[model samples]
Target: MRFAHLRVEGQTTPRLAVVEGESAIFLDEVMRRAPRDLQDLIEQGPEGLARVRSAVGAAEPGTSVGAAEPARGAVDPVASDPAAPGTLPRHPVADLRHSSAVLRPAQVIAIGANYAAHASELKLRSETAMTIFSLWPNSLTAHGATTTWPEDLTTQVDYEAELGVIIGRPARGVHARDALDYVWGYTVVNDITARDIQFSEAQWSRCKSFDGFTPTGPVVVTADEIPDPQELWLTTNLDGSIMQDASTSEMVRSVAEIISLLSRSATIPPGTLISTGSPGGAGYSRKPPVFLRDGSTVTVSIGGIGSLTTHCRVI
Candidate 1:
């Protein structure tokens, strides 16, 4: 099942909802005591998720016996009747606002130079231990949101299309073989960076953690739906040009390996968002650089997952 944190226009708060086809089913509307957010549901483990699935299924049929009003803070469904599509409250996806699919994650960890081609192009070592860094929570933004940075800050803003992994269970010293077991779901991530700051800084975290730099999601697909995380494809489209094209299989270190390596030192808490590194073809390396300018629109897409687009603005 796919999930997202969405809000209707004029709504200040976001609610957890299950994405069904083109419509969204607010979980709080169907479940008596719903999990507050994606983090809450993930911590509840498989049983809690199963309950959510059951509730969504029942509501899809528009059955009245189990229908319930949304919780106090939840988005109000158009009608309570389970069987009536008219009763289902749905806003056009384009019109509704989106929030980072996983809100309040403990930390946002990112893997850099993980793809062999990306490493070579940037002249970074990919043969050594994985290059892992943290991105501040401030960087987290939702799909369709605008990302802005001061023009003086950096003239070379570049995009790194990545696949995001959300941790479900607390993990410590896990083996690569069992690393995937701790994952809850996956989403698309645009690891936007300020090239000038990155080269000057010793640590990469600060350079990439600018507010609104990491735009994640449109939706998060459950792990079960993606049996092999490494088999998916990723692409980055800047305006109308397809700049970066590669597959997760090109990674120097697979998702499972990265998780295991990190767990060896720190306890990766639930809801931690890990953005697996991007492929080659960053604008910086192009013959003529193609940095994002005001009014630029960038979209990153992952196979089976969804496209996450961000409008660019320069102050």
Candidate 2:
């Protein structure tokens, strides 16, 4: 099942909800002891998920959720009607706001130069040891949120479209063949970066970890739904133009390989989010860089997952 952290307007707390097309079923409304967030649900393991599945399945269709229906006059009529096409006892996703897809992830590891084209364009070596970096948790933000940076800091801000993998179980020394079994789900990520800082700093984490730099979600799709991560397509749209269009098939290191390689030395704990590098077509490599500016809107989309959009502002 697909899940997202969403909240109604005027609320500061985000609640985990199961997404069904354009509607969202807040888990607390259906399950008495629902996991508070995606991290909690993932840590609960298979039994936890099974319980959720059973509870959601047991509820009568079109009953406005099992026992914790929305407060009176709060339901959207179009999404609650039993006869309405694809209706459920749910609220329209359009009515809700999003939080980071994987809140409180154990860690956010990023793979760099994992795509041949992206590596070649940046003049970085892809044949050598993997270029891995940690993204600061403060950088994490939700889809549709605004990401701003000071103008004096850097002018070459760019967007990278990438796939995010969330681990389901502890993974250490796992073979490539078995790496995927540990995956919990997938989400879209826009690895926004400040190109100027990236090249000057010896390490990459700081340049890319500006507040709101990593915009993820809309939703996370459980691994069972994605049979092959490499078959997906990733694209980036800046303003109104399509800037990056590529396939996961283009990665120099497949998702399984990256996981296995990382697991060789350290235990990849459950709820860890690994951003599997971005494809080429970065604005920095354009004839004249097309950096994000105040009022610019960028979106990164991964097939089967969802699109994550960020509005940019330069102070």
Model 2 clashes, total count: 0
* Index of the highest-TM-score prediction: 2
The global C-alpha lDDT for each of the candidates, from Candidate 1 onward, is 0.85, 0.88
By TM-score, how accurate is candidate 2? 0.92
- Per-residue lDDT tens digits for candidate 2, residues 1-315, read 899998887777888888878778777665656789999999999988886676555434454433332543223222322222333357778888899998999999999998999999899999999999999999999999999999999899999999999999999999999999999999999999999999999999999999999999999999999999999999999999999999999999999999999999899999999999998999888888788999999999999999999999999
Provide the clash count, candidate 1: 2
Native RMSD of candidate 2 (Å) = 4.7
C-alpha TM-score for every candidate: 0.91, 0.92
